[model samples]
Target: MVELSKARGSYVDPAPARVTVETWARDWLRSQSQLKPTTLVGYESALSKHIIPRWGRRSLSDIGYAEIQHWISDLSKNLAPQTVRNIYAVFSLVFSFAVRDGRLVRNPAEGIQLPRRIKAKRGYLTHAQVHRLADECGDSRTLVLFLAYTGLRWGEAAARRQRQSIPALRSLFMLSV
Candidate 1:
């Protein structure tokens, strides 16, 4: 019992280090004020559909590279490449927060291999097709023609106001036959 008495002065209680993944994840989600509404919704979806169901109850210290790699491999068999990547990104973010808050020494989600997303081939419209599209659009013929000719994205076209006129738009419409 003499050794116990000798060590008593040096035996300071270590800081509480047993935070569950769910607790940290909730806190992390709550703290993300800068994220856009759509992005926030996506993050929540990923957590609920994938990460939280698998690892939410585990402590941060209990997770490791092997466990994460295995989980990702299992996910890849059924989920799409992009979906798996999105879910992994959410998991990585929670671990990153843990590291920043001193709950973890490093992010376990880092450096894991993920399936590459395949790009779909884009189809280009011919002049005839553009004219046909404009004709089919009826009342929005000008808008359709403008979009087809200029290749403006849907959001960009939707945001354009008539009051803020582009001088080049008028010139572009004078198509020489």
Candidate 2:
């Protein structure tokens, strides 16, 4: 217990552990004004669909490694590895807030092993394949050829102005022939 001196006398109160996960989560979400709208939506979705349903009512001090591990394992059984990681990330963030507030000694969501994500293999197109794609695209052939030859991503290609890209494409065509 910590003591505080009042005007009349001293008062002692035990360390705080009464805050529930739901309460802390709400406060944490409300505090995230700098987050993007889409990111905020994702965090809210994860809390409502996963974390809140299972652990919302539990007191901050009552949650521990075992409980968190069990919850993650259960989620992994049905959800994709990335989805599981995202949901766990939300839980970890809320618990971290509790720890920072002195409601807990450590984050219970720390150090848990999660499912590994598998990356798909990328395929490269040959000259023949690029020619065929350009032929099929007809009027958009220049765009297709530019993408294949320059390796610019969709967003970068879309943002390119006609005057800027035409010279570059002509230079590339000169080099290729």
Candidate 3:
């Protein structure tokens, strides 16, 4: 039995059995120095807004698959399916760290079924529709036209500097004229 447990990576130190979910989650968040600022914010939000509330006082070993799954179902009543998934992701990450750090023999939060994510149908504007919107923007007509023809996302385009984009805009203007 010892050999089988060792082979399955189920052998762990008992010291972490005393650590609560909130304590470990904070430690995990602090260790994530390489993550983007926005991603860190999302993790913190998921922890504070969802994961920590129910699991905070519970020790790592006290969290079970059934409880986690039931919590997800309850969260789906008021939150989007994607939001629930995000919350679960943070919770799961905390447990995974505990396993890797030898705090737990195995994660009890594994193998739970998550709600299916529903994708929205994408719509595209016609050329005339794009032109009408550009005309409506007046001063920002070129920006609208650039967005329509280029595949750049709003965030990517918003980060552009006028100095860096004038060359591209000049060519676009040449074609429009």
Candidate 4:
């Protein structure tokens, strides 16, 4: 058999050099400094406080979906649902960066099913109830009246003058029943 050293062109192993997930994440974090100050700070904080301690040292190529799921499950222990979702967002962004930079063939976070968000319950008032409330309310209740009628916020109404309009907000309020 040919000597191992003679078979390869260099003294180093012929296998592709390994880049760990942590290193790739760090490199991505460094790239964030060029973004908005608040954005860079947010990314850096997420990386240091959340992503690094959990996933920093693992080999990028070896981090499969199971590991990611377990990490999310672990996060669920102490974090609120929205906070966990934010963690998922950071992971997705990092993996997307890895894919764009050619450090990863595919983003492992792409298809990992995140926890479903609990939607707020919306309650509607009947026409009679609305009329009774409006009759009892004064001019100061105009904002709430508008929220019930034209469905505009106090800010939106406050922001409005005769010459200006919010087309999108108008469109949303005017949707067909």
Candidate 5:
């Protein structure tokens, strides 16, 4: 009698207990057509690499806060803090959707303490430092100076264009995007 009230009101049908985490997650992903490309990729990566591997075979109703906390603790030992948070973001998103979809009464992924992301102290390049770096860069002097002044953050995988940047910077330098 108590279980009847907790069922998805529909996705449960005759057997709510049989509905695995993977099952609910797949449905949730299908309903999330509005996600951006990068967000979708991250969500999929979280599922395939972490969430699904740990919980895919388990039923939706079987999950709870303590187990998730332990799993997160395990993840924190290996991954960067930000990466763990990103994974938990995707995990929480799925369980939140399940609650909305009526598969659960509340999100199990909520209230768990995630790792903190500590931002690196931003270092400024002095005028002399910039000049020295530009001199060392030879023909790429213009590129070095332009990058030093701009606060735009770039990662290792970020694309850099050598020939187009000079002209592009000249035109776009005045406007802050």
Candidate 6:
């Protein structure tokens, strides 16, 4: 009869666990290709330069509020408020995905406060400039005026049809013109 070695109280595996912040973030980005090209590029840039380096190796479940708070504090010291807020937004996406994937029970980003930034005043077209712009567009005058007045997005405005009535337009779309 061959003798067998006895096992310990509990079986233990020596393999290293694989879940990490970077992997989760990469998966999310890959899943978001439906977003605009510029938006995808922006996300990739933020992840490469900011979000990944700080929290990449951390397991999704291991992160907590205090850890995020410290990171936010440290970021505020070195980055402008707007930039820090953008960085935090990237972290928010990662944590949000973690919760959705069952990797984490809760999102650590939920209660973390972001630094507030004062936005620069926007520059509007002078009356003369607006008139000149409308004239220059010629056939496209209506589209330009519509964009400036109503704030309808470029895609939605471009999709409008000529036969669409004013009442229908008022309800289906608001004309900036």
Best by lDDT, which number? 3
Off by over 4 Å in 4: 1-23, 29-45, 123-139, 162-177
Preferred candidate (TM-score higher): 3 or 5: 3
Better of 2 and 6 by TM-score: 2
In order of listing, the candidates' clash counts read: 0, 0, 0, 0, 1, 1
Candidate with best TM-score: 2
Q: Assess each prediction's global lDDT (C-alpha) against the native.
A: 0.81, 0.83, 0.86, 0.70, 0.78, 0.74
Off by over 4 Å in 2: 1-15, 174-177
Off by over 4 Å in 6: 1-18, 121-177
lDDT of 5 by residue, 1-177 (tens): 547654734334336545888887877787888989888888888999998989999987888899999999999999999999998988899888877765576788899999888898988777888878877987766556667777455552136664756678656533422
Residue-by-residue lDDT tens digits, candidate 4, 1-177: 237644663233212225666787777777776588887777777778888888888766767888898888888788877778887887788888867765565777777766777787999998777756765775434334556878777787887773454444445434422
Q: Write the per-residue lDDT of candidate 2 for residues 1-177, one digit (tens) a residue.
A: 233334434332214656788888999999999999999999999999998889889887788899789889999999999999999999999988877776666788999888899686999988988888887997777778888977899999989898988777767765542
Which rank order by lDDT, best down to worst? 3, 2, 1, 5, 6, 4
Worst 10 residues of 5 by lDDT: 8-17
Decoy 6 TM-score against native: 0.59
Pairs of residues at least 3 apart in sequence or in different chains that clash in candidate 2: none
* Cα lDDT, model 5, residue 121: 100
The residue-level lDDT of candidate 2 at 136 comes to 96
Off by over 4 Å in 5: 1-14, 138-143, 150-177
- lDDT score for residue 82 of model 3: 93
Model 6, range 93-173, lDDT digits (tens) per residue? 877876666555567888888887978899999766765786699776666666766788988876877677344544532
After TM-score superposition, the amount by which residue 63's alpha carbon in candidate 3 deviates from its true location, in angstroms, is 1.6
TM-score of each: 0.80, 0.85, 0.80, 0.60, 0.73, 0.59
